[model samples]
Target: MRVPRSAAVWMACCMALALAGCGADKVEASGTTDENGACVLTIGTLGPLAGPAADFGLSMKGTADLAAAEVNQQGGLRVGERTCHVRVSAYDTGYTSAGAANGAGEFIGQGIRFVIGPMGATEVTGMKPLAGRNDMLLVANGFGRDALQPQYPLVFHVAPGPSVWAAPIIAEARKHFSFNKVTIVATSDQSGSDIADVNEIRFTQAGLPVSRESYQRGTQDFAPIVSRILGHDPDLVDLASTPAADAGTMVKQLRQAGYTGTFCRLGGESTAEIARVAGGNDVLGNFFYYSMVDLSDPRMQHLSAEYEQIAGRPATSLTLGWLPAARALLRAISAAGTTTDTQAVAARLRQDPLEDPDLGRGVWTGQQEFGVDQEMSFPFYMGYIRDGQPQPLVRLEATQP
Candidate 1:
């Protein structure tokens, strides 16, 4: 008999609840699946550990693990009088929906109460039922709209939404490009369309008349759409896509067709590796994107140093997104003093006001004021791809969108 997605977590729920001891045993850390639930209260970050977007998942995972290590070092999460050192069960989702669903089942079987995950939209959707069934809270790192919409009460988003991103991209365009006309091209999927929605709303709101085209995620030819965009004589083109190999193909075709207008991408790919495949110089110079944090900022210099030690690479703004979300869950669990019931912690997330600097470098408010929508209140930073690297635009002052 095939178990339902939620059943896996539900079956393990009793075992997990029994196994939930708020005791701070020696903090044992390992990066293997065989070690699941070997220690009390295991938490995890699920994503590609050795796949195509491995760099993307690994960088974020490194930061999450580092955050866990830091908390555990301080004697772990304090649930009332008991201190529980967190054990992490990091899993790879292989950047596929099926892989993510299976990963969710594994974490449930391991009897985990909290999870950080599968950094893409499809993957998050795959794991949603499992999280909901277990009543376990999932802090998602991706900006997929489905996770937020249709409301996963048990799931929380740490990264700001695409709505948080769009206004800033338009604002930056005004400084660098003539704001006469614009075109937006996006994937037909939920994540892509959601980002396009933000771009369309903000583009006109920013006082620039905009035109748009929606394309399938992996379409080989954009010339037909590019032809339509060029007819508008657009000064700018917004390309919104999920991070994957297909986005690279689209970027290459756009540039190869001699489209000179600036093309700004939403969430840059794994490591600018997309640049190499998508025509390094041409693609990098014209890309406008949202980067969650700036490693160059003196404020984030500390995290940059630490990220290098942890992930073996300089931290990008996106790396900062996962840690704060994970920490938020840990904080709620600590404040509520119980792991068996996430409701108390969920209530704190709903009832209590939060202003955390580490999460998103500013004050945070939950659904109480925002109507069951806000996960964190970190402001978005406008970024551009420069010289084969992603960097902050720097000219536009930061503001909430």
Candidate 2:
């Protein structure tokens, strides 16, 4: 027998309450009706707006703003019998733990109920308490596995978690090139280490031998790390979830070292920025990343044009997922018929999968990994870069293994 979506959501919530020891009543959404009787919903964007990761924060904020504008232009979202408009408030967290706390504080102060991002491990953990306290629904694009529990049930992850991405990335590697052995170069931080560890396990599971190396986060000179990675003389070099600048620098140094092997960045975003930093496409040789989207689709083309018109530049992979996240939140709110009940929105999200325009079909299910069911699983796009130009190849469906 087919189970009802509401029944599934109710069971998930009950399990969360029992396991997370978190009170659903602690935080409350504070949406208000304007004098015009239209529901006014405020959403927040928390990320690095001032530091080295500012580009990522700005792109997230810009894409979110565009999504809101598009919704408002369409006469607003339907919330029960009324129409609702969205207001996006962005905070510059400097990509630090303290900044994340401060941004969360600001959101709480303004009674913001929905948030887009605050990428990275440290920042997401820092914002968890505030998110829980404020009863806000946070849709983050970072590594949220460690922070996800019944305690922070409001927090949702849009990116692939743990074992999910490994199979597809490995399969793509073998298909794109004849790569059997791999070497990993990741930042020596909690986030990078977690990703690298997962990659190691997944590669091993896929019957591929892997070697791993790490460098400090701010190391601009990647020669030392690149030298160590190349020492393995592996057929593939995995830049495991490195930031844009660092990954680009590593790519440049690897090319200069005459390492003509395949280059793969598991968390691929901001390809144009990486290409520019790597001193052009010639240096970015035989690159493979897992974050490409079909921009040629009319819906995507329209979104991209709108984003470029608003952001004052072209949209890259980094900006692609924000719209889907925003749309999903709206979808949840409409389904729940109320924005004040954050859990209701989350419940609706878990039960009903959305046809995401950018990320393809997506569903929320993480019962096996995280104790809670909040991770959004989707078929991510894979791309191939030859000489410098990236071409979107096909959708890679994640596997259970």
Candidate 3:
């Protein structure tokens, strides 16, 4: 598929900016001073801007850009004595390990101290070592079991994976749907396998027998996989960690194959896109998925409004999920009063309360899973599709560590 024109333009701009200082090895000023002599802090956003997962990457980048614009609109972030303007530098990682590592390297050359993403497991795995060596902080997104560890203190998770929220989400689904067995479909990569492993455990613990099926990344056809899944006679099909595009295609194929079972996705937020690709709500029939935000909340609505105003486009569901993390990073930088001292910034990040006027209060979790309390826990919702129409979302309270 061809890359969207808007995405292509954004990618060109970001690559040009990232490569401008490729020869610089020393840590220079995080940003250049404006004509008024105020600091300009440039933060990087790393993710795929073109590919099956581009929706996720673009959403993350857009949110980070929106966060920076919000600060700039308010006269910039106050770091001690200097008023620093936030500038976002985005790089399209193409959902590849090499692409991610290369993007991080360019950011390092440009003296970027912080990054908002590198969403894929492969991307995170590729970027972490470089980020650690450079003392660059990452508010990253990845579902791999080992995505976060105490050894990598500078890397903080944007949200918990299935290990933290899967059980509750599964239990909630059980209240409305009756499913005796489940078939989990995911990619064969670590990103897919890791999340599938977590969801398998959750489903089994909930008394549902489970089976697993995986496809290689970039597979457009789901016929063979759907055939294997139907062999299990599953009452519920869990799209665990599959990209939204792939999941939607699978949904369409499964429905065409006369499978009238319920569908659930315990991964990323892309329900609207999924529905569109699946041929609409009727094709989805009975569906449930994790919603990163309660859109009905007035504050969340305000966030979407602000994003549209600044970005000149509507925010994707996944875009809203990234705002709290981006906001947290900027707030931490402000509190630390130094863009260069990442250790101090990281310390302040952990100390600051996980509160956002638009996102409400959250908590720092992940100790039980990642052995570090660095994952931000926030209130999420379960979106339900009943008989080809959307229903009111059920809000779940935020979890504690």
Candidate 4:
């Protein structure tokens, strides 16, 4: 990925921090004052820059760059009497705990108190301790929020956690189908289990009997799993907490198994990718995927075009949310008047909800959910796969338990 103008200079600084052995003390200012005497606030991105999850990380990085560029285009951020120009610095997490911790340590040493990603659940959880230890504010775009948020108070889940969207999805699903029983097929991971648990509760609460099946990551053969799940005669199959590839595979294999049942992915990205992998949209024509943005919205169309121009590819459902989260983070810093005081910025984030241009109005609040006021609450979008395309269904208001 090409580094954004805001992040063009951080390569050497990142190398220096790595070479210095990640000292405990914070490093010097990441950027110098410009001719206007404006301070430059450096926001870092710690995510997978290489390997299998590269696309996910790069998409986030690219969109965040767009957000930063947009902020900079608006005369930068106003902080007290002077302005603070924003610069983004990206570090690769390699989709490993050690890598995530190392990258986070380097960011902490370099005085990056605010960051945008550690996109997947593994990396998000891996970097949590480091974030709390350094008092960094991470607006995460991953799952496992119900478990991690209570443990890592500084990490705010900006993306819709599995449970966060369960109520609305269940209610909507009830309206479309006559299902007395549902089956959940999820990856056997912390996030998957947590999502399944939540979905089970929601489905049961909705008067639907629910059964769950778990698959280890990288498992290719879904024939048996699909058969086993279908054996229970579930009217609805919830691909809860599945990654895009896995969800696509299950959809294809399940449909081939002649199981004409309703399908809904609880937490995943890119229905187009799923449809492509599933061989046709008809396989997933009834499939509904949780979305963070309403793609049909004019603002989204404009941003999508702009993002495509900058990224050289069309943005996916997951990619769109990061820009809004970045915008919210920057706005909070501006409101707090300092990027260094994470508490003040967090307080501001709680005080004033950010009206994301794409996702609509939302706030950073976890008080009701995680016992901490950190997670972002926003409208959840439901997208349906129709003839090889993702179509917007409804924008459900954010619900709190």
Candidate 5:
């Protein structure tokens, strides 16, 4: 995460929060920016802001912002005996590795010790060196397998990886979508391939035939790929890709191709912008996807309401994942009891695992769901789009069996 000179005011403000210790080690935390010597804790997000995948970044930004506000209003986080208000800092990486690295650098330059994203797995991978250099604790909001490897110690992924969805989606395929054949469309990126490349094996094992094709992550034209897939005439279509401008565009082309069949999209990223670009609920029907939906889980209801109030936007996957990440990190801070030590916080996150307040009786550790031991904290759900809404398809459960 190399720092660039042109960092925006949003980046600068977050840096300032980190420098000021985020009311964690303040002389006296008055809970206002003007308060003298108040500690300020900066949580940074490294996702695209205004490029192809800007919608995901925007969703991340909104949820992160909501988390910050909720933490502040709850009278701040309790670190040992002191309380420090949480503040979120956002940086737009523009969906490129270099851009993500630059944002990470800027946050590190300004003393930001904690980050919420670099959400895309590739972006997170690129920022590893920088986060290591600055000793930052990163909570990634994207695919997990890429970040959950043994070596990447600074980051914790709250989202379930591909394996979680592969089996479940396959099961759904058996139940609802009968097939002798299927066509798959995925982005031509490492993470996408990691998830998409397995369609043949998984599909055949489930007693269904499958064919696949992939395009570059930012490629919008799906005409050729659609033609080829439709030529084979798949019983159902699998979109094993992330939500970006390309994803929405690809769906439109498929719809126009007169391929009105079952469409199931794994994982999640949603926004008003995407809905608008898709133009009138065209891509809504038969869209199956996975996302965080603990709304009725008692544990998440409070935070969900708090987010809806603060951001003035409907609560979705972004808010659901972001709030938990905030609480998880805050718990780490409380356990470690220091604002300046990134490594110490990382250790706390790894070793101290926090219990989910959303599920009143169960305790979860940071390592459990991610790599640790908490099942009650991190759970995955399945859903399908019907009448333009993603209704929950499975109860929230841990990533692995």
Candidate 6:
């Protein structure tokens, strides 16, 4: 019999709780040792795998799996005298606080020492306490103002937040499209409000008048929100933190309402999906957005080729964003020489240079913004779409906070 999604999640959580009770003694420094004396390590991935933001979560899972596979294929990670074979366990959080909390519990019950996601702001907030208390290392992706606070030493950011990149992107967009006034649309939850708050500050500081509009999550018909947004008579509309699917629907509705304005998404990368959802590239005329990775780079191309070889399909730009952090986690574990002691792993991660063969080099930033230098800041792309055709992406260097 086919089980309902919610039922399946509930059953999984229950099983995890039972396991926590039964396996308390079995939990050790890391994974089990094989007959060949190889350490088998399991890393947990927490994210939404069955919701509007599933695209981002699935990308996170894919990249983490790829990182693990790469390590295993290279004869596993060498930690002192032992070899470690990495494995990945993924749990879908459904992009909710309760889901994230439950997913964290599942990981804890399974004795997972490291985790790779819980990308949304709410998901990060929900999972942080449990992960901190259990001494789990997290390479998280979230845009909340407190996503990388000093209190959470084990938590590290996968990418810099809008506070670091938004101003530069806004300046670049102004060069191509003139816009004096902006309307920002996002969801009504913390994830939306947090990112929208940052974007508003950045836009206002750039001397542009800004207005805000929001809708309840899971609202399929965006006609009312579109009407409200159009009432502001904006020259530019910024989809601050809307999921790609929701942003696509909003783009379609706004277009149908006869609003001819430039569009910008200063949040996550989902341009292709957004364009597809908005009908076609032509419908997304004069659009600007952020790309997590610059695909034009030959190194990035090689990374894509490697992913296609391993995953049997092309990797999305979003998936590429998670690669560096996932790979870094394994390297840190090797450097620390212990998978169980996350504190040591975090230390090694901070000391090591944030460099990747395919993605290039990054810096450990966020000290100025979050009072901790745990966020990874990589060079990203500011992409433009004009008259429904994509323009050559403008590569931007990573900026310091």
Whose lDDT is higher: candidate 2's or candidate 3's?
3
Off by over 4 Å in 4: 1-38, 49-55, 94-96, 145-151, 386-392
Q: List TM-scores for all candidates, in order.
A: 0.76, 0.85, 0.91, 0.83, 0.79, 0.91
* Per-residue accuracy of model 2 over 1-401 as CA lDDT, tens digit each: 33323223333433343344322233333367788876898778988776446667887787677767666666666565567788888998877778888898888887777888877777888888878878888888666347467778888875555457666767766776788889988777766777787778888988989898999867756778888988899878887777777877888888888888888877545666677878887788788776646666665676677678666877766676556666667766766667678878887666555556456676665656667767766666666787567666667774343
What is the per-residue lDDT of model 4 for residues 1-401, given as tens digits with 9 covering 90 to 100? 43433323222322233344322223222234657776888888877776434666777777677777665665666554556778888998876557778889999888888888877666777788888888998887666645346666567666657667777877876665566788998878665776777778888888888888998866778888888988989878888767666777888988888888778877655666666678878788677767777777776777777678766888765667666577667666665656677876776555544555466677555566567766676787777654445555788887565
Distance from true position, residue 65, model 5, in Å? 2.3
- Per-residue lDDT of candidate 6, residues 1-401 (tens digit): 33323223323432343344321222224456768866888888888887678888888888887777666656666564567788889998988889989998998898887999888899999989999999988999989988988889999998888888899999998888889999999999988999999999999999999999999989988889999999999989999889989999899888988989999999888888898899988888889998888777676676677678777877888787778788777767766667787887787678656666566678888987789989888888899998788899887888685
The 10 consecutive residues of candidate 4 with the worst lDDT sum are 21-30
After superposition, the stretches of candidate 2 with alpha carbons farther than 4 Å from their true spots are: 1-39, 50-52, 80-82, 357-359, 387-392, 398-401
Give Cα-based local distance difference scores for all models. 0.61, 0.71, 0.82, 0.70, 0.61, 0.82
Q: Per-residue error at 176 for model 4, in Å?
A: 1.7
| Candidate that beats the other on TM-score, 1 or 6, i.e. the better one | 6
lDDT of 1 at 141: 55
TM-score winner between 1 and 4, please give it: 4
Clashing pairs in model 1? 264-288, 293-317
The runs of at least 3 residues in candidate 5 whose Cα sits more than 4 Å from the true structure, single-residue gaps closed, are 1-35, 198-205, 269-283, 294-305, 352-354, 359-377, 386-392
Q: What's the true lDDT of residue 42 in model 1?
A: 66
TM-score of 3: 0.91
Compared with the true structure, what per-residue lDDT tens digits does model 3 show for residues 1-401?
33323223333332343344321223223446768877999989999888778898889899898778777766677665677888989999988889899999999999888999888788899999999999999999998888998999999998878777788888888888888989999999888988899899898888889999999999977899999999999989999889888999999999999999999999777888888889999999999989888777776676777778778888876788777788778777766667798887797788756765566688889889888899998887888888888888888878862
Q: Distance from true position, residue 59, model 4, in Å?
A: 3.7
